[model samples]
Target chain A: MMVPVRCFTCGNVVGEHWEEFDERSNEGDEDPEAVLDELGVDRYCCRRMLVSHTDLVDVVSPYQ
Target chain B: MSEEYDVEFVEREDREARFLVRGVTPAFANGIRRAMVADVPTMAIDTVRFIENSSVMFDEQIALRLGLVPLTTPPEGEFVEDDTVTLSIDVEGPDTAYSGDLVSNDELVQPADENVPIIDLKDGQRLEAEADAVIERGKNHAKHQGGVGVGYRHLQRVEVVDDLPEFEEQESQIVRGVIEEDGELVSTTEFDHDLSKRYPGKEVRLEDVPNAFVFHVETDGSFTIEELVTRAADTIEARATELEDAVQL
Candidate 1:
């Protein structure tokens, strides 16, 4: 997964929430904003880190 | 006799807090800030050994991710520097790996926030690793930093001159202060640095109190902000006492 360790702007640790956020958003049970709010992520910088991540591990791992 | 110093709470919350300190020297104020940013110690993953890997995330990447996870710092006197806390992760593919998966050998030093995502595995992928946690100061690295946003500002007093032109049209664009009765601009009760930038040439003047400071602290869940501040104060006191003892010696 292409999870960032920290928010670029605020430097708050954010990579930990990517899995649950992805699962809930994909299941259509909740939107990204609601999921982030529930997770106690209140900053826009940290929120953007989750909403913009893409899992490129599958493609990159094959070359390794 | 030492001058009396007063601490007033401006705001308080679980992860963040702000307070005002009055009748203190600038050196003392900055000492607290330095102690908070560099002296206070926290638990962080210092080393990682991969046992198995079939996932796409590289070993180094996985290690880096694990190292950044904030581990709970035990209460005062409970932390031993260089002591090892082990964490192991074992997971199969077709799912996601999280900080919750990394179980700690010591219950007191587990991940502060459990829901952090470490990696995502496809149907056939798997990852296993063992991580060692160590107590370190923020001076050694940011990962060991107890507080994320530890800073302070001089308390400000703002006054608006009424002789200036009233730019009612630009009122909405003001970054700080609010329009009040008689079309006068009044500084907001909150201390904000952007007050002067609200209007380019407006008659708002701000004066900073030399001996009064407003401190703002935000923690990363490894420890309470209050605990961090208290510990920082203790660290400063210890250092000062050491200096005095050396002078006597």
Candidate 2:
């Protein structure tokens, strides 16, 4: 349920950048585009990995 | 006789690089690409044993995630292929278990990116695991692939043919990879991959440079770009030698 370790399309490691992307995009007002760009995540496939990830780990962990 | 090859780096970085190689056939160029993708060896979690599992996620799921986490591969001779490195993690509830938390027995081999989230433990849930990372070739499993993205294209040579017809709307001509103009290498990105933009109001002829190829390689942090490339070249050489010896015998 956690962020995937690699992009579904390109297999690039995007999990490592998830925490910073979430923190900056949610806490600060920085644009997600700029944040992804700054993180050197250029491919649309890799970008989708961060934008579309739903951290269901917290949601599912409470059940079991 | 050995053929002399010329190599020029179009762009170089820690994890990725683009280089132009001359004096090689398309098949030889493809061989280099294939070797980089499938022959290079790197460390990846091969077997994971769970000491405790109170989290919601299944042990298998957690193991898959751990296997995907890129680990820093030490230099050759430090560990041979199939050598195993031990790493264990223990995290209690009210917190998350990140890759950084994995305690590795080998200092030289650790997680390349620390922030990779393995799982999130709730208030009382716990996750403990001991994994054996084995050095293996990408041919065995994709998780061991050091070169995540490896590809090449023929080097294009652009020649200005003549001026475009007056008042003619110039259609967008897209050209990717690197191009050679006036004996200088230029990446297509420099002109936004649009040939019309680089040569305005003019017709241009694009031709492939015989025996020249441009390769773009990106690694998964298991190793440096230089190491990935050189190791790939070494693999090819070794294979060629083996073939020669077999034919003689």
Question: Can you give the DockQ of every candidate in the order shown?
Answer: 0.46, 0.75
Candidate number of the best DockQ = 2
How high a TM-score does candidate 2 get? Answer: 0.94
TM-score of model 1 vs. true structure: 0.79
Candidate 2 residue-wise lDDT, B1-249, digit = tens: 179999999999999999999999888899989998899888999899999988888999999999999999998779997689999999998898999998999988999989888888888889888999999998888888888768999999998999999999888899999999889999999999999999999999999999999999999998898899889999898898999999994
Residue B229 lDDT in candidate 2? 88
DockQ of 1: 0.46
Docking quality tier of candidate 2?
medium
The model with the greatest lDDT is 2
Q: Candidates' lDDT values, in order?
A: 0.78, 0.90
- In terms of TM-score, the best-performing candidate is 2
Which tens-of-lDDT digit does each residue in B89-172 have in candidate 1? 998988878888888888798888777778878877889989899999888988888877677877766567653466543232
